[model samples]
Target: MRSPNPRILYTALCLTGLSLATSVIAQDSNEEVSRIEQVIVSASREPETGLNLTLPWSRIDDDALKLTGAVHINQVMQRAPGAWISRGNGQESLVALRSPVLTGSGGCGAFYTAWDGISLRAPGFCNVNQLFDVNSEQAGAIEVIRGPGTAVYGANAVHGVINTLTADPRQGPEHGYAVEAGPNDYYRVRGEFRAEHGAHAVGVHFNGVSDGGYKDNAGFDQQKLTLRHDFSGEQWQVTNALEATNLNQETSGFIRGFEAYKDPNLKKVNPNPEAYRDSFALRAYSRWSRETGAGQLSITPYFRRTSMEFLQHFLPWQATEKNGQESLGLRLALSDSIESFSWSTGVDIDATRGWLREVQDDDFSPNQPAGVHYDYEVDALSAALYGQANWQLTSRLGLAAGLRLEQNSYDYDNQTDDGSACAPEASACRFFRPADREDDFSNGSINLGVTYALSDDHRIYLRGAQGFRPPQAAELYRLQSGQEVADLDSETITSVDLGLRGAMGGFSYDASVYSMQKSDVIFQDADRQNVSGAKTRHVGIEFSVYWTGESGWYAGIDGNIARHRYDSDANLLGSRLDIEGNDIDTAPRHFGSARLGRDTALKSGRSLTTELGWVHMGSYYLEPDNQHEYEGHELLNLRLALALGKGFSTTVRVSNLLDEDYAERADFGFGAYRYFVGQPRGVFLEFAYSPE
Candidate 1:
């Protein structure tokens, strides 16, 4: 894999300009662009607006996102309530929604990330950095379902769900293009086109970015394209979406030592400069809807193909890992209204085939082998059925209940027997890979809620739900020397939530408190063996409030304060260790952000907007033992934009304005403290054009 050179990036920008010019030639047909509005979220699996939602949620509209200057998911998610998106090396991130910044092979399966209501990867093959597959930078809206999602989403919806939607073509015919340049020789080009003719509509988007990076040999280049089409008939409609993505990343491993992020020299040096990751994905899905006697019915069918290869620089013995998967899935649902109740039912099915291979190329210890350590293939099948009903119990009271049953099965085939050994040169080994095996799990989820409307603009609700997820393929197949087989159960959580949500005049607010208990938690023991059947507890309060006055001023604050702790004792090495009531690692107790901005009208139908934002994170333990902790930091950001005309705009953004040195992520493992250094103070300029 190779990063794009300066000349290539320049050529790419020039081609984008040519495309924009070509789109302008179709102006013979005059059209008026409609104003953008906040959309009702479909991820809720119900027909409800944000103001009427009983569950804790958040939405980032196009207007607020403009002031963010967001290039990464972390930048935008920070504005949401109880959400923490941490960035690693180039385009890599981990999400935390009412949970911790989960790590390890099992981390990716704890949250569900989707594009247009479709999962990025199959259940067992989830990538931790799956967000890179979606073009969120150009999305129409980003919806977040905090805590356990609706029953219709099924597995991997434990902590929360993120769904990104593409712009609708009905708002066209419209064309948009943007060019951005910033510190570290960064450059990006983006373009979009939407048009509608009679009953058919089409939308297309393209994005590309290249950066020289701040650390040595740490650079990346990425590109993505999405195409969508919609066709409507008298009583039936069909929508199709297709996307292709490619990424080449030169990864930078963490720097070791306490407070190492403050060292300017160390922050610029890449400890593992040879690390790189290259990946590609192609996904397509179609949704069909028709009017039925009972109500409206919809069916969706999807296909996915993805492949990736990366170097394991964090491990002492560097290994080259490769994996790929192909899947076919279908979802069906129906909704109708009864006398006083609204109900919906759905079913989901999926089948996938995948393979994984790992080989050690650089051995730092003589005890570790230098040959192929793992090679396997797996076939996975999953199915689920769910139903939900909402009833108006009284003039001002409502009740909602839902139930879901799901099953997952995996068939594994091991192609190598030398996966582990008592010695690196041993003739045979018996520790890591066991004989071919089949594992299956059956789980269920339940959701119940009650709501009372105190007035037209005030409401309160109570909700209790259960969520579960089956074990991931890596947790079962990626074996260490101490174990011959992994016997794990599905992780489950039970939570109770109480909240108030509503809009009054020019003010809107959402606040909630939740208590949860998780069973069968998966983790690595002191013996360095993977196991399940542990327990944990979580409790938190999160809220968001925004006020917009007629004086053109607006302000809002959103944040979460939480505690997560282990509630079980364990057998470590050989002796029993009492770890009850210990705080969970990487889970901060307090974190949130605030923003203040204003919009002013200028001369001749123009306007100017500016925003000032602040972010704060509290200190937290870096290890399960609760002996090591990281001191968190606060940050400030500024953004200013001017509308040049009806079709053009310009913006100036400054990040880390105080130039404070900090760590984006911190951890203690392998007998040392490691950190991913955060970016320093940087200035960026942006120019955009959107014709009406």
Candidate 2:
């Protein structure tokens, strides 16, 4: 499980043999090599053409999201391929796709996040740093589907799915603005607008940031907003969206011993300086499609609200929570075609009302109680019905299938006075409360696929899937110590994938290999009850590549090489040693990112671009009886842009560029070892304006 970094696997096998030898020398140079298809929309939710998608997809376009003006969101979701995201401190984060980076409370219900395709928190409430509540810094695209996207995304999509696409106003009039600055006292501002009139279109995007801490009193301030509207006639078409987010943080905990993120003054020490976090979110949606006759029909309606308060300060009795939620939803879809077979069907409905509160002002011991150790309220309902089909069995083969049926219910409602919050024999308390309850979960998902086509720029595929989630609501009413009713079950994953994808001349690639198995899997044992089967296994190889050589140069890579073990053998955390095939804590057998760029035009007309980036992290095992490890890190980044034509522009960025002392996350509980260090060598600058 530890091998990788043979000089980045020999530069990823010499850039996969130089993109298969320049795509067979540009198909024998008789010229003509422009294919360009690539289109995606969260698979099966509409737009398609990810080379006849049968699964494993990736996208992160929009000019790499404005040259990755990202300050987080793990810098554009690690450029896709088997994602990782990690990064904590400030805007916090944790997500691993194709599994493992998962943490408790249902481990964020096993991956599924969305903005344009809704679901940003509903299905039983999830939030492992809820992707900082959307706006993906004004996303234009960010699709990813690594594995098991729950038979077309229903209930948590088990091990993958991420959408976030917005910004489309008939692609017309536009306006932009930017300002940025970096290092500790950072600053940022961004804005965007789009317009169109004839059939109405409008868009707006926003951003805001303020940072100051590197550690000693961590800092953060954030904001995001999005609004969009579009309407087209001649047969109904409407789209509307609204998004908002806010965050105020000053949280930092973790900086313990062992390797202390390579020291440097304990990596900027910040021992929970009065930890904090505050959050807010809002969402709205409307999408209606047209052309119907039992065929192309779509409808969407949504709303969401969120609120949060933090300072759990990594526990040991530092409680202080507060949560919120309010939601309403609807989605319906139908598509049709017969002869060669094509089909689509959908239905989803959601409802939520949530609340939580925890408190502890002192009294850090006596079974760790202070007061109010949990007050709850929940009311969740989710429903789903899905279907998909495709067949083309000839023109080079194709076939696909899907199905989903889901239901989730939770009624909960206990505002104190359930079970242990201490006092009744103190020693057996550690905040357990669960009294009024009602839970239900019914799930199912399925998928199958096939694809052939060997020429016309490659294609080959195979897929199989199944995914599920349902057991969150704070993992069944937040219990602890004297547990109470958390006989959980729904958590599943089954997957298979094999692949090759295409595009020639200018080079493009997608590669895959997968295997997965996950079952019941819900933990907390070692007496803190709340359990479920527990099993895991995942295998992987993932890749993505791009090239655009004919002069202005470009290159890309995204990576993965995985393993996530522990299939059976448990005790949750009393560690009784012997973990089934180990390897799972912070799983990372390999990680990736790479890019190289060039563009020039100057001669007074203005244009220049330069880029270089590489990021890698491979070492793993920080627990799960694998005894502790974390020797991975690599980073370098640089960017520059210049264009001074009337619509002004400027950019410069340098992140960790060679100043590496890493650990953007690492841990090994209570017995020591922790981190979240990483972040050095900063440099940033930006200024922009647009009009053309």
Measured over all alpha carbons after superposition, the RMSD of each candidate to the real structure, in angstroms, is 9.3, 23.7
Model 1 lDDT on a 0 to 1 scale: 0.80
What do the candidate models score in CA lDDT, each in turn? 0.80, 0.83
lDDT of 2 by residue, 253-365 (tens): 88899878777878888988999999999999899899877898998989999999998889767888989899998888888878978889888889999888988988877
For residues 191-233, what per-residue lDDT tens digits would candidate 1 score against the true structure? 8898888889999989899988888899899998999999998
Indicate which candidate wins on TM-score.
1
- What value does the lDDT take at residue 353 in candidate 2? 92
Can you give the TM-score per candidate against the true fold? 0.92, 0.34
The alpha-carbon root-mean-square deviation between model 1 and the true structure, to one decimal in Å, is: 9.3
Deviating ranges (above 4 Å) for candidate 1: 1-39, 43-47, 362-366, 418-431, 571-577
